[model samples]
Target: MKAQFPIFDICKLSRCEQEDIFISRLAPFLDKHQNLLLSHKHTFYHIVLFTEGAGSHDIDFQRFLVRPYQIYFMGPGQVHSWSFEGKVDGYVVNFSTQFFQSLLLKADYLDQFPFFNGNVAEAVIDLSTNLHPLILDLFEKLVHESETVQHLRQDMVRVLLVQLFIQMDRLSFERPVHQATAYNYTLLRNYQKLVEKNYTSLKLPREYAELLFITPGHLNALCHEVLGQSAGEVIRDRIMLEAKRLLTNLSLTISEVAYQLNFADNSYFTKFFKKHTGLTPEKFRDGLFNQLSQDALSLQ
Candidate 1:
């Protein structure tokens, strides 16, 4: 039998009675869990802010250079690993999926934040010099609240998190272009959510269009206008991303991966994977292992 990839939960990482959330300073957290340097998946949402640090962290196979005043967010089930060049310190919070459901009126309130939408590109943020004090203050309060047994401590933490998210979202808007109107943006986001939920079984833009009550042409045009990709390309990209993620697990063979992705056979899967990624599934897996081995050796 092959070894399964590690998946950690907030309950296992914290001793709090609720076990729904865990918060700590980054340096101590790293000292306690050095194994985090290796790739692992988390069952809880993760937020980290680097007050001081220098290193690289990988999220879903995408590597990002670490810097001071940088914050990153990861939703459940995303694979991540870290490597630090020197002393690293920050604030880290891990919370369950249901952490805010009871406190907030909207069950999907967290999804409104772009960082939590599973787009790695938008998830890691670098704060401007002027915004540094504000961001730092919020994190400091969060740490203090987590350490104290005060009235409505959890509620306070939730409020702080929402404030932090709103601040970041506001910063994101300062970018040069905001093409989609409010109605179109909501529609596009909803379409993306559907694709994420049904990517494995539904492999066409038309299928997703029907679910969204929009014509396939409108869907394709919206994707191209906002995302610079066709609707079909978006679906294909999601399927390809899942394929890459599943391939990372050494326990599963290529054929097994195909079956899980709803492909009829391994051959077609190989063709599709290679055509999109320029590497066969076997080669991709082999290269991934080799790269990991190199990373381990470098650390040693």
Candidate 2:
């Protein structure tokens, strides 16, 4: 059997005695683990701030250019890969999902932050020159905290991390346009959560609407008004994303992938994948391998 797509957890990546969290200067971290250059998923929350670098990173198939003082956040299970042009150095912090659960009263406190909400566009942030020094200081403190065995070390790290998140959130440019009313936004978020949890088995808008305690028409209207897409489209996008993630694992056959995704059959799955991505599953996997090969060659 071929190798499965890489999914890294905090325990596997942590160099320190603390298994729940890992923090270090990005350059050495990258040097120590070159495999991170390839596509993989993380089982922990991944945060990076680039002080100096020129590169492109793909988060869930969306590519973004790297720049100085730019930071990116990734919630667990998001597929990402990096291609750097020159020496990359900054700060990187990886913490398990439970890192904050015990520290904070609210279990979903991280989810409240836009960066941790699993939206690639919102997760990557560019800080202004005025804010760079302040953000840099916070990261420095986090690095120092991680290096030393001080009193309340983990708590201090959590405080600094939360402060960093708030600082980024306060930036005017960081905010995405608010299209949904508070009620609609809450409802939409709930709907999205349900879709994420049940997408593999529930494919219809009405099914989700029933779960949301609203009519299908209401759900469709809300999705269009807030997301600029139909409710069905939103569910379809989630399903398609999972299909792509699964396809990255070369060991999984097309039929197996389809079965795992709860598709009717292999043919139907192929048609769906092709319709959305314009490439069959096999072709898509082949392209990924070719791209990885080219990337490896370029690095050499």
How high is the CA lDDT of each candidate model?
0.86, 0.86
lDDT of 2 by residue, 138-222 (tens): 9999999988998999999999999988887666233544455779877987888888789999999999999989999999999
User: What TM-score fits each model?
Assistant: 0.92, 0.91
TM-score of 2: 0.91
Name the runs in model 1 displaced over 4 angstroms.
1-4, 15-18, 294-300
Q: How much lDDT does candidate 2 score?
A: 0.86
Tell me the lDDT of model 2 at 165.
81
lDDT tens digits, residues 215-273, model 1?
99999999888888899988897888789889878878999999999999999999999
Best by TM-score: 1
By summed lDDT, the worst window of 10 consecutive residues in model 1 runs over: 1-10
